[model samples]
Target: MNLSFTTKRLNVIEIDASSSMVEHHQLTIALPTILTPAVVANLPGYFQGIDSIAAAEKWLANMLNECRLLMLQSQQQEVVGLLFIYTEKHDAHIGYLLAEEYWGQGLAFELLQGFINLVGASSQWHKLIAGVDESNTPSIKLLKKLAFDERASKENGMLFFQLDLRKYPLEEGTI
Candidate 1:
């Protein structure tokens, strides 16, 4: 999806190959602080082992080749995070990372809501799933606040949450 969205405080744009170098630079700076081992503990293995700019570039390239990666840019055009959406059969898996400095200001929530809006308008997906580490209370709280239901628990201290888009209201402020 080549799409872009503007919220009150963010501009989310789907990163394509043309803008990959810029995204690579952003990831190089963001990975050290936001994609640290502790923050990415609950995420999949692909997030780990990235400790250099080249690795960050390769990882970002892989993600771009494999899934839909939307860069979340602040009003000043700084890349603060990314929203990752990948598909498995009929389910859409969602994941994200935001700079530590941008946390707790409700930007993540706004970013997620924007994604929900984007997905709601698309017909290719019917459900959203997220596997958040059990120890990450902030992410758990954020998922719950968005009305995702705890569905199951997996190994590595991961808890899976699901949101059935068929049941999700598309109206504004509903979340």
Candidate 2:
């Protein structure tokens, strides 16, 4: 999807691909330093704590050089999820782990919908793709709801789902 100007229909806020994943979930799709030292220190538990924050930060920063990161942030500026765009290939990858406190709500849909709108406008991208583990039904359901076609099987250790950004416009309608 091609990154373009944002049009918010709900509480969502839209920003450019240059933004960080720091606000992609519940936040306004904007970039903000909401990850405090404590959150950063403990977030490794969320990421399996296999790497240090410094290493992660370096990794994230390096990722920024090759991709665009969009985050979902809450009203209180708490980042709830993340979206990553590999600009060159026009592929989008998401990694969202909502806090246990906010499960069962449709927040992921809201976040992805806006992203679809924003990304679909891009002429740079012929397609947008997401990969999910077969066991991740919630994410698969969300992707299917968005109308991304699933490939025959898994690839690179994950199930691949793709949308022809030129054909399946996110603004077309609700699934």
Candidate 3:
């Protein structure tokens, strides 16, 4: 028989998906809403279809229709980026999209490792998985630092990874 355990932390706040991207120094976290405009604007080559704020807002209006946002807010208490789990079948997918300004600062690992560690300990999760676009080298390196091993890869697509549940207990050893 298989059983999954869940953790309950009272201190964390779940923010709305439609909100502004919070800023902390080099980091600019996108509130769920931020993605739409930023994505629509396709500000950088990262997003290629969105070019207008209206389109961004319309796009965001759609994302908010389905997902919930749980994030690490900025010092001023504004929602930064969206950090939440994407689960399917027996695996949980962990991914986040922060502004390019925050790139290469080691903040991704810091935030991701903390979030995963906080929830992994109490859950009955059998495995934790992550996927990164093959072209993103920095992210590839960061994931390795977090103890995630590559399970498979595609030429120009996302790389798949997995970590043993035993290796990431939220509280080190006990539930």
Best-fitting candidate, scored by lDDT: 1
| Candidate number achieving the greatest TM-score relative to the actual structure | 1
Better of 1 and 2 by lDDT: 1
Locate the minimum summed-lDDT window of 10 residues in model 3. 1-10
Query: What residue pairs clash in candidate 3, if any at all?
Result: 5-123, 5-124, 22-80, 29-80, 40-50, 40-51, 41-50, 121-170
Q: How high is the CA lDDT of each candidate model?
A: 0.81, 0.56, 0.53
* Alpha-carbon RMSD, candidate 2: 6.3
Write the residue-wise lDDT of candidate 1 on 1-175 in tens digits.
Answer: 5657889999998887677666657756766556767656656789887777777878877888898888888999887888888888878998888877787899989988877877776747789998887888998999999989998568678889998888656566669
TM-score of each: 0.86, 0.65, 0.63
Ranking by lDDT: 1, 2, 3
> Residues 68-149, candidate 3, lDDT per residue (tens digit)?
3355444454444545466666567776655444446655665666566655666656677877777677778887877778
What shift in Å separates residue 65 of candidate 3 from its native position after superposition? 4.8
- How far in Å is the alpha carbon of 157 misplaced in model 1? 1.4
* Ordering by TM-score: 1, 2, 3
Residue 109 lDDT, candidate 2, scale 0-100: 75
All models, RMSD in angstroms: 2.2, 6.3, 7.4
Q: What would the TM-score be for candidate 1 when compared with the true structure?
A: 0.86
Candidate 2 lDDT over 1-175, as tens digits, reads 3333232322333334444465322243212233434223323333333244454454455545655655445666555545566644555554444544455688767767776676666556777777776777788899998888898877646788888778645444554
Native RMSD of candidate 3 (Å): 7.4
